[model samples]
Target: MSAGLLILFYLGLSLGPLILAWAQELDPRTPWDELATGLGFLALAIILVEFLLLGRFRLVTGRVGSDVVMRSHQLLARAALVLAVLHPFFYISPRTPAPAWDVTRQSVVDQSWHALWPGIVAWLLLGGLVAMALAKEVSGLRYQHWRLLHGLGAAVIAGFGVLHALRAGRYSADPALAAVWLALLALALGALAYVYLIAPLLRLRRPWRVREVRHEADRTWVLTLTPDFRGRLPYRAGQFAWLNVGKPVVSLDENPFSIASAPSAGPEIEFLIKEQGDSTCRTGQIAPGTRAWLEAPHGHLIIDKHPDAAGIALVAGGVGLAPLMGILRELHATGDQRPTALIYGNRHAGQIAYGPELERLAREHGTELVHVLSEPPPGWTGETGLITPDLLRRHFGPPDRHGWLYVLCGPPPMLTMVEDTLIDMGIPAHRILSEQFVYD
Candidate 1:
């Protein structure tokens, strides 16, 4: 979907309940009471919508990119938490039985044990859930354990929140708003089931086996996988896949890695994984024939979608060169004649991956290859210092270079600087595509 449409869809889903509640034309309460109900409606809707954001649905992330979707998931979750936290406090209505004349029960807020218990439990769980997520990196918990806890916690909170709304909320008593809550709750649960249960079961049919594992650069290993099935995976050049190496179908051990080889490179796939994390640190120990499960291609840092561009500029740092390599390889295999440039930055000479292959591309593919090193070797001949705007100006400063497509994949700080520099240089925002690995 286009970005505007995706945002419109999200607003509709998040605000639809509130709009429906207002349309009920029920008896009016105090301004504070109505505001409290509005907050509750929005909070629950956003909470339920969180399920779809992290569900890895292609229809949602295909256009906006996984990074955008995941970031949205994190931000919206915090917004919902804030609204939920203040929802009850804003209610100034008296905590008493509804008078005989107040048929709509708008005169007082419900305070019965059954009505309050579910909301209290859900509210507390929501706080814990967000806290655990924010502390995931430092918690020392396995990625799989964190995922399970987060999914189950969200499901429980959604269930209880809906129950509380039905029992305690005056506007929520309307059958229209009640049905909306139930549907959202059902969808939230369904999303969890699809991610944890259905997707894994379906992946069993497309198994893969590790074909080769070899050292490439400093602390980086190149892994090659071959399908045990009939055909190759249909993926765009720069997309990523979730690989569950030596794990069960229902396992949460899967991790996303960008494809380092092009689809045109045949059935075998390659990934340049840097030893930095739990599974990645043990890359060298993985056997050549280990069983693996492959998920569908996920990412939007692709050049094929921008066929109108006059040139392709690939900017990468460290192991972030994985996806950019796939795009370059694809261009070479298809004999694309569009002008291409690669500005790769690393700490030193030893950190540059695929040295011979990149030089070969420069020689044969006529790619304008430039390497930036923060700490150069004794006989360094390439550019020295980080990839600054001054360095970028040397290559992309010309008016003719304004129409080139710039693809970036790197750490957050480097990406931010490069993107800003490119935009400032008059390259349109839509032409710059990027993806970073930052799940937490």
Candidate 2:
């Protein structure tokens, strides 16, 4: 089905009960039921479209135009929250006789209040979630901390929503509809359980024991791994795996780093991690014998799948050289002699990751290497001051904007500028590939 049809179908499922109520087929006696059922279905639709159709969880190969999916998910979630609130308040406000709350009221002294509490809690949590999502900035709140709270808050909201629905009976008058809602809820919960519990547990079971952790120059550590399980993890170079450093709390945290080593180099996988964050800061302290969890190679930048082109341009900034190293290694291993040029960008010569190695590889494979230093030493002989359009043209002979494939990996600002330059130079969006190493 077309996207338009899918959207219409989703909307119909969400508003079906309300439409029925408008037609007087849905009993007005169960106003509580009407509100709950409508909200529940709306929430389910949001969950289905995001997790199932949009592939939000499958961070590997999922490509649902980031802007479109993010905006839609946020909008749907906010609408669902509004419906969640209206469901209970509408049902309880003396508007409907033989109310769902009245039934609970007749049962016990404060049963009505108890039934009402879940909805209230859900609303409170949902309100916070929506605010956090929409807010431009939260004063003094760190992004990671806010993200963790957001996740926990979402869980609480979902739980309360489920509880509210179960307690309010009239809205889900049709047993089949109620069952469908419950099934969708269960599926969403299952997706969560699989991601946090089952998948991680499975990864834990099949650990990649630390075979080597060599501290390289420029505060970067080269980690080597040998799968404890018999065979090697079927992975492509330039892809990354989640590394579980072994402290009780740390073990639960998995950080993704590029597979710096070649795929042809056997089961012993390697990653070059630069110490730049809270996680990486302590990674160097990890002992030799600590067991590490590995989530296999995940990225769509594999050279073979991209495009068949004559010449390729690989751009790197600081530690962004890791993936390019993998790409070049793969090209060399296969004897694929496509004239390649690597524009290595860094603050200074000392900050460049894989500098010597890249130079050696270039000499061996006849690939061109151009080092661009942003903050060069007074006597520095390398090309200086950023990966500008002029530098790119000078070293690689004016970018073949329409034809040549440009693979970029760098800090967000640099990447943005580079992308803008490419677009201005008449390169189609599809022809240029980029992967942002956003930790979150």
Candidate 3:
């Protein structure tokens, strides 16, 4: 459906101008001014429809419609470029006694190939905009910089396209085309305003207040936030949320953090934070009652929907144990005894963030806990070295079971290695769920 709609939009965008131009030449008393008015209406409708479908506010489940809208806009933009290039050629009259291309005696408009330079630039920028969208996820670029570039590109394309059309005075030959151009310019500006100004401002209105801050071993801090809203944050146990500190206008940078606490029956939320990089290093100073913002509840690693599974395998490394804590706590709370097995890895036993709590939960819930350490002192027991395939096989049985789920979370390389090992050990791809904290 999305592909077909995009094709229809492309066809309409390509033929709109040509059909309007031809309708005028067909009737001597055709009131070309009326045709121009209609052209304006058509352009207005086209741009308005694009915004209505592709605008930022709409949320389709799992970003399904959003992806479709993006692809549709890209196709239309490309078609617009082709039409823009051909528009001048089609309108130039062969018998108008206009001179052949000349360099010196030409007016400024004719000197620049009928002002095609501006349209050419506009087309290039529009193409760049589409390419940028395609590379957004792959490039791992900063969001603020990407947003600014996207906005600037949109402004340049819309602004230059309008200037190109009006400067030629060809659109003035049809009032509708002129009106269409006006509406298109306004639509483009409106989109930018909504994205840059309104959305960010709204995210500021209701913020989370830090309720408590507890420092665990190894410089890990657990931040509990009480959302201003009265209900619990609608997030799954393994999902993460974007947290904002500082005001909307100035400190607009927010980092995504995994929620450490279970989906509690309360209004408070919690995040298990590791002080690794720049934004997180300052987490020590995040005092109680400090205001923060949240945008959230993403990821597909939760165990909520898989109630009938025979068992679950939870693999965690370092602070990646946070979400696993939520899962275990929820299972304990709900009195679930589904033979859950946890394989936690750390450099040393001292670096485990939720060591004590996990031990207690394991004892109470009858869930087996296996610890893997990279470096252990003399006489140290339990499994050692990385969570390699040999260790997994020695601990758990063969991975070809039908009713088991595997959840893994950690740094990228470690997770990749473990995931590959599991696949090689015969685990089904769909049975394994993974999460990565680092964002592009």
Candidate 4:
């Protein structure tokens, strides 16, 4: 689906509950009480929608990049937390039993133990959930453990929140509003189940095996995976997949990596991984023929989406060259005639991946390759220092280059700086595509 349609669908789902409550047309409460109820309803709806934004659904993350989806999830969670926390304080209604005439409980807040206990529990748990997520690094929890905790905690909060709404909410007494809350709760929990259970079950049927693990640039390894089945995995050049090597289908040890090899490279998929984490650091040690699994084809960095562009500009920093390498290789393999250029930056010469192949592209495919190093070795003739605006102007400042599609994958600071520089140079924002290597 188009990005605009996806956003409209999201808005419809999030606002459906609030709109239903408003349509109930019950006796109106004071302004503060109405404000409290509105905030509470909105917060619960947003929290339910958070399940689909967890970066697991290909439909959601495929159009928008995974980094964008994940960043939205984090930001929206914080917003929901703020709304939920302030939901009760705005109430000016008395905390006492409802009067006989106040059938909709417009004169008093529901203070009975049965109605209030669930709210109290959910409120406290929601605070702790957001706190733990924000402080995950300092909490000293492993990524896998933290993921499990996060999923369970969210499930509990959803359960309690729904219960509180059905029991204590002024508008929730309407049968239609109660049904809407139940449906939303079911969908939220169903999304969780699909991610943790159903998806893994399907993955178990299409297992892969490690074909090779060869060392490349500094602290980097190029690992290849071959499917146990006959057919090859289909994917775009600049896309990525979740790699679960030497782990079970259900394990959370999988890490997302760009597919370094092109689709034309055959059944065996390749990944250029750096030794950064516990799973990645053991890349070289993984035995050939070890069992592996893949969650294929995620991300929106492919070239087919921008076919009308006159040219392509690829910018890479450190290990960020993986996906771009896939794009370059695909172009070369498919004999794509579009003009192409690469601006690769590294701290030292030893850090550049596929150096000889890149030179081959420069010679055979007419790709313009510019190497930028922060710390150049002796006799180095290339540009020095970071990828500055001056260097960008030297290559891409031409009026013709402004129409070319600019694709970037790099460190967060470098991506931000280069993106800003591109925009400042009058390149339209729609022509620039970038994905950051780090989401946290």
Q: What would the per-residue lDDT of candidate 4 be over residues 67-147, giving only the tens digit for each residue?
A: 999998899889999999999999998998988988879899988899888888989998999999989889989888898
Encode model 1's per-residue lDDT on 1-440: one tens digit a residue: 78789889989999999999989898799999999999998999999999999838988888798998999899999999999999999989899988998879888988999999999999999999999999999999988799999999999999999999999988888888899999999999999999879999998889999999999999999999999999889998999998888888788888899999999989899999998879999989999999998887899887988999999999999989999999999999999999999999999999999999999999998999999999999998999999998898888898888999999999988988999999989889999998888865
Question: In angstroms, how far off is 286's CA in candidate 2?
Answer: 2.4
TM-score, predicted candidate 4 vs. hidden true structure: 0.98
Which of the two candidates, 2 or 3, achieves a greater TM-score against the reference? 2
| Candidate 2 per-residue C-alpha lDDT over 299-392 given as tens digits, one digit per residue, 9 for 90 to 100 | 6556675657767788888788788788888778778777888888988767777667777888898788888888898898879898897776
Clashes in predicted model 1: 0
Which regions of candidate 1 fall more than 4 Å away from where they truly are? none
lDDT of each: 0.92, 0.66, 0.65, 0.91
Summarize candidate 3's per-residue lDDT along 1-440 as a digit string, tens digits.
34456557545654565466555553322243334323433333343334434324334212322334455555654554444444444332222323555322122223254555665677567667767866987767776567568667767776776666555444334687666567657766886676556666776655788898888757788888988765667887776776786546334376667777778645677788988756788888878888788766755567876776778888898888888777877777777778788999888867878778878878887778998889976787888998887887676665434467888888878788878877877777767777766532
Q: Which 10 residues in a row give candidate 2 its minimum summed lDDT?
A: 51-60
RMSD of candidates 1 onward, in order: 1.1, 5.6, 8.5, 1.0
- After the best TM-score superposition of candidate 1, give how far the Cα of residue 410 lies from its true spot, in angstroms: 0.4
* Candidate 4 whole-model C-alpha lDDT, 0 to 1: 0.91
Q: What C-alpha lDDT, on a 0 to 100 scale, does residue 372 get in candidate 3?
A: 87
Candidate 1 all-Cα RMSD: 1.1
